[model samples]
Target: MKSHWREYIHCDPKILIGKPVVKGTRLSVEFLLGLFAEGWTEDQVLENYPTLTLEGLRAVFAFASECISQEVWYAASMVNQTQ
Candidate 1:
Protein backbone atom coordinates (compact mmCIF):
# COMPACT_ATOMS: atom_id res chain seq x y z
CA MET A 1 0.00 0.00 0.00
CA LYS A 2 1.28 3.40 -0.94
CA SER A 3 0.71 6.79 0.69
CA HIS A 4 -2.42 7.15 -1.44
CA TRP A 5 -4.37 7.10 1.80
CA ARG A 6 -3.90 10.84 1.92
CA GLU A 7 -6.37 11.14 -0.92
CA TYR A 8 -9.09 9.04 0.66
CA ILE A 9 -8.80 9.80 4.37
CA HIS A 10 -9.21 12.99 6.35
CA CYS A 11 -9.49 14.11 9.97
CA ASP A 12 -11.84 16.80 11.22
CA PRO A 13 -12.61 17.85 14.75
CA LYS A 14 -16.28 18.03 13.76
CA ILE A 15 -16.23 14.51 12.48
CA LEU A 16 -16.17 11.65 14.90
CA ILE A 17 -14.13 13.77 17.33
CA GLY A 18 -11.20 14.11 14.95
CA LYS A 19 -10.84 10.44 14.28
CA PRO A 20 -9.49 9.76 10.81
CA VAL A 21 -12.29 8.88 8.44
CA VAL A 22 -12.99 8.25 4.82
CA LYS A 23 -13.27 11.51 2.90
CA GLY A 24 -16.85 12.84 2.80
CA THR A 25 -18.18 10.00 4.94
CA ARG A 26 -18.59 9.23 8.66
CA LEU A 27 -16.73 5.97 8.20
CA SER A 28 -13.73 5.99 10.47
CA VAL A 29 -10.60 4.15 9.54
CA GLU A 30 -10.72 2.46 12.91
CA PHE A 31 -14.20 1.22 12.16
CA LEU A 32 -13.24 -0.14 8.80
CA LEU A 33 -10.22 -1.87 10.25
CA GLY A 34 -12.37 -3.31 12.98
CA LEU A 35 -14.62 -4.91 10.41
CA PHE A 36 -11.63 -6.63 8.91
CA ALA A 37 -10.42 -7.68 12.34
CA GLU A 38 -13.82 -9.22 12.91
CA GLY A 39 -13.37 -11.35 9.79
CA TRP A 40 -15.13 -9.18 7.21
CA THR A 41 -13.93 -9.69 3.69
CA GLU A 42 -13.31 -6.77 1.38
CA ASP A 43 -16.29 -7.84 -0.69
CA GLN A 44 -18.48 -8.05 2.38
CA VAL A 45 -17.53 -4.58 3.49
CA LEU A 46 -18.14 -3.10 0.09
CA GLU A 47 -21.45 -4.86 -0.17
CA ASN A 48 -22.55 -3.56 3.20
CA TYR A 49 -21.21 -0.03 2.80
CA PRO A 50 -22.21 0.95 -0.67
CA THR A 51 -20.43 4.25 -0.53
CA LEU A 52 -17.02 2.70 0.11
CA THR A 53 -14.85 2.11 -2.89
CA LEU A 54 -12.04 -0.31 -3.45
CA GLU A 55 -9.53 2.50 -3.38
CA GLY A 56 -10.93 3.72 -0.11
CA LEU A 57 -10.53 0.33 1.48
CA ARG A 58 -6.95 0.13 0.29
CA ALA A 59 -6.32 3.61 1.67
CA VAL A 60 -7.46 2.55 5.12
CA PHE A 61 -4.76 -0.09 5.23
CA ALA A 62 -2.13 2.22 3.83
CA PHE A 63 -2.92 4.83 6.44
CA ALA A 64 -2.69 2.25 9.19
CA SER A 65 0.59 0.95 7.84
CA GLU A 66 2.04 4.44 7.80
CA CYS A 67 0.92 5.08 11.36
CA ILE A 68 2.40 1.84 12.68
CA SER A 69 5.62 2.40 10.75
CA GLN A 70 6.11 5.76 12.46
CA GLU A 71 5.64 4.42 15.98
CA VAL A 72 8.19 3.00 18.45
CA TRP A 73 7.82 -0.11 20.56
CA TYR A 74 9.88 -1.84 23.27
CA ALA A 75 9.59 -5.00 25.29
CA ALA A 76 8.39 -4.52 28.88
CA SER A 77 11.12 -6.88 30.08
CA MET A 78 13.78 -4.73 28.46
CA VAL A 79 12.69 -1.69 30.42
CA ASN A 80 12.33 -3.60 33.71
CA GLN A 81 15.69 -5.35 33.30
CA THR A 82 17.38 -2.05 32.62
CA GLN A 83 16.00 -0.75 35.91
Candidate 2:
Protein backbone atom coordinates (compact mmCIF):
# COMPACT_ATOMS: atom_id res chain seq x y z
CA MET A 1 0.00 0.00 0.00
CA LYS A 2 1.10 3.54 -0.65
CA SER A 3 1.93 5.82 2.27
CA HIS A 4 -0.58 8.57 2.88
CA TRP A 5 0.84 12.08 3.04
CA ARG A 6 -1.56 13.01 5.82
CA GLU A 7 0.11 10.41 7.94
CA TYR A 8 3.29 12.45 7.76
CA ILE A 9 1.92 15.98 7.87
CA HIS A 10 0.29 17.36 11.01
CA CYS A 11 0.20 20.44 13.25
CA ASP A 12 1.77 20.68 16.72
CA PRO A 13 0.01 23.79 18.10
CA LYS A 14 3.03 24.21 20.38
CA ILE A 15 5.78 23.85 17.83
CA LEU A 16 6.08 26.34 14.98
CA ILE A 17 3.00 27.95 16.55
CA GLY A 18 0.77 25.26 15.04
CA LYS A 19 2.23 24.92 11.57
CA PRO A 20 1.95 21.59 9.84
CA VAL A 21 5.12 19.56 10.13
CA VAL A 22 6.39 16.21 8.93
CA LYS A 23 5.74 13.38 11.36
CA GLY A 24 8.54 12.74 13.83
CA THR A 25 10.42 15.88 12.78
CA ARG A 26 10.12 19.63 12.85
CA LEU A 27 10.05 20.00 9.05
CA SER A 28 7.08 22.04 7.98
CA VAL A 29 4.98 21.29 4.92
CA GLU A 30 5.05 25.00 4.10
CA PHE A 31 8.82 24.84 3.90
CA LEU A 32 8.64 22.21 1.19
CA LEU A 33 5.87 24.09 -0.57
CA GLY A 34 7.95 27.24 -0.48
CA LEU A 35 10.73 25.47 -2.34
CA PHE A 36 8.36 24.67 -5.17
CA ALA A 37 7.04 28.23 -5.19
CA GLU A 38 10.67 29.26 -5.49
CA GLY A 39 11.11 26.96 -8.53
CA TRP A 40 13.11 24.20 -6.90
CA THR A 41 12.85 20.92 -8.77
CA GLU A 42 12.37 17.74 -6.81
CA ASP A 43 15.97 16.81 -7.58
CA GLN A 44 17.16 20.19 -6.36
CA VAL A 45 15.14 20.01 -3.18
CA LEU A 46 16.33 16.51 -2.45
CA GLU A 47 19.90 17.53 -3.14
CA ASN A 48 19.71 20.52 -0.83
CA TYR A 49 17.71 18.80 1.90
CA PRO A 50 19.37 15.42 2.03
CA THR A 51 17.04 14.32 4.79
CA LEU A 52 13.99 14.39 2.55
CA THR A 53 13.25 11.44 0.30
CA LEU A 54 11.33 11.47 -2.97
CA GLU A 55 8.36 10.05 -1.13
CA GLY A 56 8.43 12.93 1.34
CA LEU A 57 8.55 15.39 -1.52
CA ARG A 58 5.58 13.73 -3.16
CA ALA A 59 3.85 13.91 0.20
CA VAL A 60 4.21 17.69 0.10
CA PHE A 61 2.32 17.82 -3.16
CA ALA A 62 -0.33 15.43 -1.94
CA PHE A 63 -0.79 17.31 1.32
CA ALA A 64 -1.15 20.68 -0.34
CA SER A 65 -3.55 19.28 -2.92
CA GLU A 66 -5.69 17.85 -0.14
CA CYS A 67 -5.72 21.12 1.81
CA ILE A 68 -6.82 23.15 -1.19
CA SER A 69 -9.40 20.52 -2.09
CA GLN A 70 -10.85 20.50 1.38
CA GLU A 71 -12.41 23.97 1.54
CA VAL A 72 -9.35 26.12 1.93
CA TRP A 73 -10.16 29.71 2.78
CA TYR A 74 -8.20 32.83 2.06
CA ALA A 75 -8.77 35.58 4.55
CA ALA A 76 -9.61 38.88 2.93
CA SER A 77 -6.93 40.70 4.87
CA MET A 78 -4.30 38.16 3.94
CA VAL A 79 -5.39 38.23 0.29
CA ASN A 80 -5.22 41.98 0.31
CA GLN A 81 -1.85 41.91 1.97
CA THR A 82 -0.50 39.80 -0.88
CA GLN A 83 -1.59 42.35 -3.43
On TM-score, the candidate that comes out on top is 1
**Could you tell me every candidate's TM-score relative to the true structure?**
0.87, 0.71
| Residue 34 displacement in candidate 2 (angstroms) | 1.1
Candidate 2: worst 10 consecutive residues by lDDT?
Answer: 1-10
lDDT of 2 by residue, 1-83 (tens): 02498766778898798998876666789888887899988899889877777777777788888778788699999999999
Candidate 1 ranges beyond 4 A from true positions: 76-83
lDDT tens string, model 1, 16-58? 9999999978999999999999999999999999998999989
Model 1 deviation from native, Cα RMSD in Å: 2.5
lDDT winner among the candidates?
A: 1
Clashes of 1: 0
